[model samples]
Target chain A: MTKIYELMPDIQGEEMLILQNLCRDYSEEKLRNFATIYRTRRKDPLLILVLTLVGLAGFAGIHRILLNQIGMGILYFFTGGLCLIGTIVDAVNYQQLTLQFNRRLAMEVHQLLNREV
Target chain B: MWCLLNTFFACVLRTFSKKTFLSLPCKDFKSDDGMKSGIVRFFVHNFEAWFWLTSLILLAFMPPESTQTTFCVWHLLGFESCLGCGLGHSISSAFHGHWITSFKFHPLGLVAIAILTIRIVSVFNQNYTFERLNKKFTHDKNL
Candidate 1:
């Protein structure tokens, strides 16, 4: 009897592969949608502001935890939050965060865009 | 002291002054005007239209220095950093032994800069295709 995995081709599309051995389960269709929206729109550059606020508002350093800006996060956590000044600076320059994120995301989608037929 | 102050202010002023976009109003200018126009786009969305309007307003009012400072010009993006912090400082540090300073500024700073420099050289020093192709060659190994 043929399994469902047998019916559907693997990512390489021409081979027999197990579903369990694979990584994330995002389908091409979903990745395509993620790619399309990411490519065609402008994401709000306000995330920097948001992360900045989180960094300031918490002792655990919400900003670092979420954004993975690890070094600063650790610094803030240890120094009794001396980095608030830096966070304020980031809030003021929120546009840069937006632009940088957009550029990186665009690069990510560029890969997907190249992938989709 | 004065030279350092002058340099810092110069960078700040440059930051404010950089012309990030080129624009000509749809009413006043013809789109087909040639080469000096580096890149051009006719904004379709309402948001983009608003952005251009805002840009023009900024063009009219703000000095360049204040604007550049508002960028992610330095690492305090409210969180730690990303891979790109200390990028500006790393090259400057390499000439000096600002190793700890640069690493504190950004871990991937020098590496990112080196890779970027190499890539840029390759792009110009050779031929590269910025392409639109299929996903087979673009598979996600992590997925």
Candidate 2:
């Protein structure tokens, strides 16, 4: 039986705990399915951070669009990330943003696996 | 002041570095007792929403023609023009019922307000759903 850590080694700490809690009662096959799907869907915080840094140069808001925030992306695009203050803040809070997105994705995956069962 | 800035930058660098990016500090979730920390956690969790809201309010209150000082880093860096240069004044003018002036200052001022307003609402909605899902799982564990 592969543990959650073995299945998703990149996820750690609170994210790991949350995933474990989510998959508490799942069988090995279902857990594997969930992990596979969730891994592909999850956004990497480091990638987001890099995109945000790029935003400082001229192309602000690509990160927001990548995170499924179209309105914000547009706003950032037009306003230069609210004069780059918003971009700076986003750069600082990249971890929280990624965690929020990944947690939502984890729940969606859990529901998906449940439906398949 | 330098020490504080250095520590802040160091912390930011550490957060972005490959090695420590995955294991985020559990400060937001670890403390459940202190009232102050809980408020801090709430702000941290919904930072984007709060930021837009605060910016809008500040813009609303700012005088339309005041040119005493600017907080724009681009201007500080000696750039003569920036994409967001007049946005703040435009929004402020719009808030003060001068739509024509707002348009003159920045064509997208009104649109920016609308977009930011929508973003704030959507962010709060997302936060609500995330909290509800978290509660649902924690409840199941107690059962």
Candidate 3:
């Protein structure tokens, strides 16, 4: 009886809780499928943090683009991450941003798996 | 400077990792203080949405023509100009109905506002639908 977190060690506690809640009724096979698809879709918080730090070096907004926020990515790209204030803020809140994106991803995966069955 | 940046990043990562491990999972919902925890969880889950909303409101209220001190870090660090320097002022002017002045302050201010508005809406929409799904699941489980 392996736990959901065990399957995805990169996921934070809050995200694990969300995933567990979503997959409460899933069979083992379905859960594995969900995890496999989700692993490919989810963004790594550490990667986002590094990208945001790159924003400080005059290449800002790559992280936003990675997160599928193209408009914000462009703004950050042109404005130097709102003069680096936005980049600094994004650095501090990288976990939250990643969590939000991952939560959406988990929901999408859940729906997709359920539709398949 | 590189050493300083590395140290800062390391500190941030350490703090975040510590917080992540300490955070409780779904078991918190079954506790005696369900209502309090639910409210706290809502705030924790939707923090980014609230942040953008608060910032937009504050910007909307700020006087467009005030002689405010600059808060740009690049300026403080002795840089002559940064691409984002006049963005806030531009947004403030736009909010106050001065489209020409907003463009004069910064051409991209209006575009930024539109983009931020869209981002805020989409974030809130995602949370709304997800919460509804959670509630439906819980209801079905109880039955």
Winning model by TM-score: 2
Ranking by lDDT: 2, 3, 1
Better of 1 and 2 by lDDT: 2
Clashes of each: 9, 0, 0
Cα lDDT tens digits, model 3, A18-109, are 88778877777887888899999989999999999998889999999999899999999988998776787688778878887888888888
Q: For every model shown, what is its TM-score relative to the native structure?
A: 0.34, 0.84, 0.83
Q: Across residues A61-105, which tens digit of lDDT does each residue of candidate 1 receive?
A: 445444444554554454333324345434544443344345345
* Candidate ranking (DockQ, best to worst): 3, 2, 1
lDDT, candidate 1, B7-63, per-residue tens: 344345336423422222222234454343322211111221222233223333433
Pull out the clashing pairs in model 1. Answer: A115-B134, A115-B135, B15-B68, B16-B64, B16-B65, B16-B67, B16-B68, B17-B64, B17-B65
Segments of candidate 3 deviating more than 4 angstroms:
B1-28
Candidate 3, B42-70: lDDT as tens digits: 55555556555666676788787764556
Best by DockQ: 3
Output the lDDT of residue B13, model 3.
44
Residue A104 in model 2: shift from native, Å?
1.5
Model 1: share of native contacts present? 0.00
DockQ of each: 0.06, 0.45, 0.46
